[model samples]
Target: MKLHNISFNNLRRRKTKMAFLTIGLVVGIATIVTLVTLTNSMSSDIGRKMDEFGANILITPQQNGLSMNYGGISLGGVNFDQKEIRESDLALISTIRNSRNISAVAPKVVGAVEVDRHQVLLVGVQFDKELKLKQWWNVFGKAPERGDELLLGSEAARVLNVMSGDTIDIKGEKFKVSGILDQTGSQDDSLIFSQLPVAQRLLHKEGRLSFVEVAALCSGCPIGDMVLQIAEKLPAAKVSAIQQVVEGRLKTLDQFRRFSYAMAGVVVFIGSLIVFVTMMGSVNERTTEIGVFRAIGFRKSHIMRIILLEAAVVGVLAGVLGYAAGMGGAKLALPMMAEGKQVQLVWDGVVAAGSLGLSVVLALLGSLYPALHASKLDPTEALRAL
Candidate 1:
């Protein structure tokens, strides 16, 4: 019989053992595939949300004192200089080399003030640049075109029971409401926007700004490093990278993913053990057949090859099936996992190739002991066994 025929016959004769071996491989492959796919999808989901925040960098006035605590445990705070950034600082940032991504800049001046019966936050914004910074803002009516007209966020409009074409009193001065913005679930949703000059004059701080919002051209930009370098140059201003603010949460998610991968490794290890036991049992049951092959001048290497081929077949089938199942599960679960945010699923080719290769190698390793025993079988002793 040909070598292929021998392998096929051997597997058919030991159906129970083959089934058990395949099951073990399937378990291992499934765990690895699911965890890897989920992790990759999750990282991409987070990155997309961060991009929605618009600016890559945020320049803010340094806070004087702040502290955080958990369960009565207090952590110290770093004292920061509270100097406000000027238009000259904005000009300086614009001059940095490799600053092509710095698209539009807008300074914000925030203060608490009373608008009619309700107290609200007043945010000063430049008309042309503010529109660029808040591109997602949906306006119900006409946007503010003059100093006398102001735009209210959805939440603020609701609180004041006001709408576009209404008038509201701020600091004893009546202002016309020109627009109401859509809800964004952000701080902006609770504030009102007006001309920067009007805000600075009302707040009694002319030519001063609380922070600068910088919209960067995200394509092929190393935003985090650029923000840091810009911060170093402007020692008086505090630079905040939007990416860094959310990096801690991202890191925590990454650790969770690593833990999942570790658990998958354990599952694969158990699968390897199952393969070893099943293969060993098959070798014991086929001792007489092995002896027949030996007597017919089949080399020990040929016997070893047949056993390894059976393992390889099981591994490949398991890998292909598991990969298919894992991808289906990911597609179904991604929406739930991301809390209604639609995230793109990326099947990393490197990960897929590596997983398939590892599965095959693991199967070969599991078959090693059985292959060795078959190779060293004594033909005389095996022929007398039955």
Candidate 2:
């Protein structure tokens, strides 16, 4: 019979030991897979929600500005060209190559207006797009539902002594205060939000926009490329990406990923140790059988091959079982841990193949010393015990 046949037959005879060893490796591999899959899922979720978090790009008209400094002296007179972005031209933004990544495009027209005799800044916005972009906004009442309705910022509401359902006159037209924006501690806090077209007519700045805020997917897909694409489509507008938010999120996810890897490594190490100790014990118990084989003219390499072959078979079985269990565990755990978000698990064939290969490598490394010891068993000494 062939030496490999002997190895297979030996494994078939020792079902208990093989089963225990397989289980050890399976648990180790399963833990690694679960952690890795969870981390990947979390990263994807963060990337998707990046847009809802807020705008990552700000589009404004490109214009020249005068420096307030003169010969490094104390002179401080500043002048800048106040270029107005065209509201009609904003549609061209959808033509960019990366337009699919844009989640919201909220344009605004800002002007000073009198509300209840108090001078307040009025910001014209498309209520639909603005609400979609600002997920953090907590309105005390309803958002504007009509052209004659506007939202009052907390500070602006206080100054105007107005609340939701109050009426105010803007440029000889009555407008309803539809809602009061909760304090955001942002520039939005001190402004009154009006419908885009209504504000355009009220401010007498029809066809003009102050600026546009864009929410882009931030899965590290080169925001710079998006900026370049936007600039190409809207050459009159200066497109710039706000990297602080994206960078901060990316950094947080990266740290979490590193922690998962470290944990996986530790689990793998413990698994290798379990396999090594079990393999060493098996080699010792098989000493008499190995001696008999050596007496029958089997070489040391043949003995080593038999031991290592058993390990390889166990590794293959363990790897497959581990991957299945890990995927199941992750699926059950995702909903509870992901905070109401549906996490889509990615099953990569390459990852499965790599996992199987890693299992074999781990097993071989763990069994190397025991296999070597088995090979070195002196026929005379082994037979003396028999």
Per-candidate Cα lDDT values, in order, are: 0.81, 0.86
- Stretches > 4 Å off in candidate 2: 1-31, 34-38, 69-76, 255-277, 290-361, 364-384
Worst 10 residues of 1 by lDDT: 216-225
Off by over 4 Å in 1: 54-57, 61-84, 94-105, 110-122, 126-136, 142-150, 155-162, 165-178, 183-190, 194-208, 214-228, 240-248, 331-338, 341-346
Q: Write the per-residue lDDT of candidate 1 for residues 233-321, one digit (tens) a residue.
A: 77777887676556665777779798987988897788888888888988998899899889989999999999998888877877777
TM-score between candidate 1 and the true structure: 0.74
Model 2 / residue 28 / CA error / Å: 4.3
Can you write out model 2's per-residue Cα lDDT over 314-384, one digit (the tens) per residue? 99999999889888887887787565656677676765786788788888889999999999999999999
Top lDDT model: 2
Give the clash count for model 2: 0
Give per-residue lDDT, candidate 1, residue 9.
81
Clashing pairs for model 1 are none
lDDT of 2: 0.86
TM-scores for candidates 1 onward, in order: 0.74, 0.75
